[model samples]
Target chain A: MEKRFLAIGWVLSVLLLMGSLSGCGNIEPWVKPYERDRLADPIMALDGDPVSTSYLQHVYEAREGARGGEGAAGGGCGCN
Target chain B: MAAKARPVAAAAATSGRGLTMMLRYGLGLLALLMAFSTARASVLPEDRADVLYHLYTGGGVDIDGPSILVRKQVGKSVSVVGNYYVDMVSSASIDVITTASPYTEERTQWSLGMDYLRGNTTLRVGYTSSEESDYDADTYNFSVSQDMFGGLTTLTLSYALGDDLVRKADDPTFQRDLDKQNYGIGLTQILTKNLIATLNFETGTDEGYLNNPYRSVRYFNPSDTSGRGYSFEGELYPNTRTSNAVGVRARYFLPYRAAIEGEYRFFTDTWDIDSHTASITYIHPWRDYTFTGKFRYHDQTGAHFYSDLFPSAQATNFRGRDKELSELTSYTFRLKASYAFLNESQSWGFLKKGSVTASVDWLFVDYHEFSDLTANALIGEEPLYSLDAAVFQLFFSFWY
Candidate 1:
């Protein structure tokens, strides 16, 4: 079982590596820098408060059976 | 290595030692490592500080603590961050009440991290340690993030390793070790002038003693003298489990200067636990105050070996009664308000802005199989267990 898990991890890691290797160069920003004012607004900030967010995520993890894959966080127990 | 089940009451007390802090949140700052890293090919994180008070009450348990975080840039290319957190728990929980005396315990954690940026790439390294009377854990992690496609997209790859030692309070020589590993990939994209999105995928594995020695599975014992028809035995769990999760989120700016976001995630593990979670949030700024509301929903299947009551002892190779492993559905509703007291116009020295925010979350859960033993009902006629919890967060943050 352990060997099988390691194999799954390695295979996915390789696929992710391949996907990341296919980037760089120009993909023109459809929305110019100047047009991103709304996107840059504080309200639109994806993760504005790191401490608060991390604490809440930890609480959810402790109580739920699920963990990880939610925003660099864990089990998506959805107690967000 | 697989462990032999052993009976003990101390495990119920150690239940609050904290199982989640070992992971160290690789997701919280991935965006800050990328989208926020734009413009300057080598931009370190911003300097900031936060002090917070958090409280959770429910399930006959009370956990309240203080968390302090500080981040400062050491130079043009490097930034450092540190955190000190504590959890003071008073638990008279269902498990504790059933088999042992109520207990009070404290868990403290410390974390330090550094980020180095060169060109359009950022490298991060971190360490975290958590300690309690019967449990101790340490984790180390590293990650690299790149700004691709003219800063329109960001990709972050990360890995973490954890080592944990669990000890039985009543048995001086009884101890166990658990090892864990996590792998993650995150992508952030600027979808449009008014929209942004992130997709994160994480996989992990755990090995060694995975069950609580202080926790037990209940089984019918016809000859038991106790009026209750059931008896308890130590829980037995598989020695290894692998899990996978994928989550995606999107935030969009409303035409009226408000923001709305939606998130969805799917999770599955070798233990046969599958879960789906979704949430929606709305943020609105009025004058100096930002008001936000969120609703979240989650549903999951029980682990393969989870059973509230077994027909007899050793009914299965692995038996567990932990409610968290039971099929359940949960909902959370939150309301938050943040007031900005300082901004560019009212800056204080090196502090460019400051805000104090408070939020309250109401949580409710309905268990499909786990029964509430506190009711003291007859066998097989017990009421389904449910939980209600309230979480409160109050904090002040300053950014330079």
Candidate 2:
């Protein structure tokens, strides 16, 4: 099981590296920056309320056996 | 039956003086790490403040607290945030009532963080500390994020270190040390104008004094007759543990300005515990009110050393009866509402927007292996234990 998890981690790393390398090329973004109004909508925020989200995640961690990988952005991130 | 089998048994001498304290804050360390996963674009954080009240009641346990958070930008390149959180717990749950007496405990935690933005890159550093009567923890973290593909994708890398001091309430001289480390990576991709997705992976490790000081394992003793048929011995656990989790989430905008989000996570640890969790949420906004609903499910396999009842005294090299380590399935249903009391058209001085949000989550869990000792049934015929809990949260947020 440890080997399997390690292999999976490696695969994810490779995917990230490959995706990042693709950004090195002269490829054009499929979604133009100006067309991101919908994505920028407050309702569409993946981690909108950092305070509330992290608090609730804290509650779950107290009771559940599982932890982490919740994908909360941050209490403070350089995002305006 | 398990509790009636043995009333007071202590193996605390194995490790030292037997001192017992609740571990309500032991898990807060993980929250600190998850709070700053740090996946943001090449923009500065918005200035905001939040005041929140939370309550959780279920299975004869009551937890209530208040949380305050504030964030502000300094100049054009730096942003700072701080959070103060508390948890007041009164527990008479099945474990307490069955093994020992009821107790009340309080935990307080505080965190400080800073973010710096430079061109298309962002850097963050943070520190968090939590304290209780029997436990104290301090953590330091750092993260970096970059925007690529013309702002279509954001990737973040983070690491954190936690230092913990564990002590026993009854034994003033009893103290132990625990160290933890966490590593994480996250990616956010804008798939389309109306769709966005994120993937996150985290790995963590812990060493030294991993088990609960007060919690005990049940072992059958035919020679004893007391409150229960068994005896309680201090739980023994492996000193080191490693865990990994991967989660994926996607959000899509509806045709009519509504939104739907789905998420899934898989977790595994060296203790042989594996879990799968999933959730789906829908948000609908009508004028000043936004209504949201969600459903979440989680299922997990038991740890290798956990058992509801051991056959005899000192039956296993390591023993534990912590319900959280048992095979179980849980479900949660959430209802939330947020009111935009002040929007662009209605701003108040320095505030850009303000909202009040309230939410309640109903949780249910079924333990596949753990039994309801209060049932007083025969040993093997004991019925499975179940739990129902209600979690409530109310908060006000303002962005300036």
After superposition on all C-alphas, the RMSD of every candidate to the true structure, in Å, is 7.3, 8.3
Across B226-304, the per-residue lDDT of candidate 2 in tens digits comes to 7466887888989987788899998999999999999999999988999999999999989999999999999999999
Q: What is the interface RMSD of each candidate, in Å?
A: 8.6, 8.4
Overall local distance difference test of candidate 2: 0.77
The runs of at least 3 residues in candidate 2 whose Cα sits more than 4 Å from the true structure, single-residue gaps closed, are: A1-25, A73-80, B1-41
Docking class of 1: acceptable
- DockQ per model, Cα: 0.31, 0.33
lDDT (Cα, tens digit) per residue for candidate 1, span B1-400: 1111121100111111112322233343443344334343535666999999999999888888999999999878888999998888888877777766777878888899998877777788998888877778788877887775455667787777777788877788989987777777788887887888889887777777888767888999878789798998989999887888899998889989899999999999889999999999999999999999999999999999999999999999999988888999999999999999999898999899999999999999899998888899998999998889999999999999
